[model samples]
Target: MRSGRLSFSFTMLMIGIAFLYVPMLVLIGYSFNASPLVSVWGGFSVKWYGSLLHNRQLLDAALLSLEIALLSSTGAVILGLLAATALVRFRQFRGRLLLTGMINAPLVMPEIITGITQLLLFVSMAQMFGWPHRGLTTIVISHVVFCGAYAAVTIQSRLITVDRSLEEAARDLGSTPLRAFWDVTLPMIMPALASSWLLSFTLSLDDLVISSFVSGPSASTLPMVIYSKVKLGVTPEINALATLIIVAVGACVVFAGYTMRRAERQRDQEMQAAYRQPAG
Candidate 1:
């Protein structure tokens, strides 16, 4: 019966949600454990959070990770915007296919392969030029190159849906092409730009394999630190750190969603008001 099928589907949906969220819930629960050992359920305590604050190495690693995420996301967005503009607007240029393929290369390549290739490339450059030296700068460079590909893909998808006429109208009103793009096209794709930057930040923050290959011993990231700790064994401190990250990211997502909805509502109001106006 249709009713029976509907009931089964609802049960399956609930199962799917549980499958995805149960681990996160468990991790969150363990974050409050007073005991250091993750496996043992100790009474609730915020002791680990206090300890985490004074852990200099971990704090340094976290700060470095945040810096990389901010810088690399900014760099990736600029590079990606350029790539997206060229691909979408200058479709008939020579080597278009090659350029497009290169921009998308990271999406298809395995992390190990990408990491190794970048490592080798950096080594060759450093050997020849005596520069970069596989530290923070080198890590940022690798992240920019890798993250830019994703940014380009994200922006390009949004660009395809955008109306070219907006920019053209700006140009017709005596704006230069570049000015028109700055004033019109950029605003239209603001959502995509925000998305691209956020995604790039997440990718750079989450990266382990690529960062390991590119970063020096002195420039270990938060993920690198967590990974090393995990090798020894999970602890309440790590669980606490992870839970904090989850909370921070969730807060950011909520804020972004709210901003986007507000923008949409404002735009809708403006459009409706414009429609109500008498013809000039």
Candidate 2:
């Protein structure tokens, strides 16, 4: 009976993997198709990939999206570090609950609601104080709002788990509070910071609804462009574009995982070596 149950579990696991990956596999295969029609797969060809360079609209949108992602992710990291530090370092403070709720609200709140609320807020602000004209500026701000929340949550989880005594020890030395955090605590949470920044970058890059709401008529993100194209019909070019994105994203995730793993192994080795050392 145990053997039977194990086989069933294995079957379920395979089924789950197939369910998740089979569509992406099919999409990748179709990306090489010569025919424009998505349903009809012609002989394999790389023409569509080459054609992406000529598509000015798609290229422009992609560039805009990249710019927004980079800017928003950087801003989000700064905001996340500040929020995470404040929450972790200051145990008791006035409006702490409110600050916590604001930080977490984006995680729980629906994207549509967030987008709509931001749109309304932007319209109101534009009317009152002629500032932050809609376009790339608004989109980046909108992205940073939600992306910062995610970054904060990711960093906060790591921050809370870190030992406070290390920073205290540094403080006991000549190191100031800022210096202690920079020298001691910062290294410990470097992984979390990297992870949060990547997450924020991915989120900002992938955002559609929020970008749509905040972006002006002139500003279009890559997702917005792809979505518009998909509305017409999925073509070979779209498939190729998607395949490229998947490959790029997959490479990044793999690289990040490998880097983090190596760093962890090195840390473990150092700890083991330290433990083996003789006492003074």
- Candidate 1: 10-residue stretch with minimal lDDT: 263-272
Q: Candidate 2 — which residues are off by over 4 angstroms?
A: 1-6
TM-score of each: 0.93, 0.95
| Candidate 1 per-residue C-alpha lDDT over 1-280 given as tens digits, one digit per residue, 9 for 90 to 100 | 9999999999999999999989998999998899877678779999988999999988999999999999999999999999999999996999899889999888989989988888899899999998888878988998998899999999999888887987898999999999999998898789889988988998998889999998877789999999999888877788889999988887887888789778868876986898799978
For each of the candidates, the C-alpha root-mean-square deviation to the true structure, in angstroms, is 1.8, 1.5
State model 1's lDDT: 0.90
- Model number with the top TM-score: 2
lDDT of each: 0.90, 0.92
Q: Over all chains combined, what TM-score does candidate 2 have?
A: 0.95
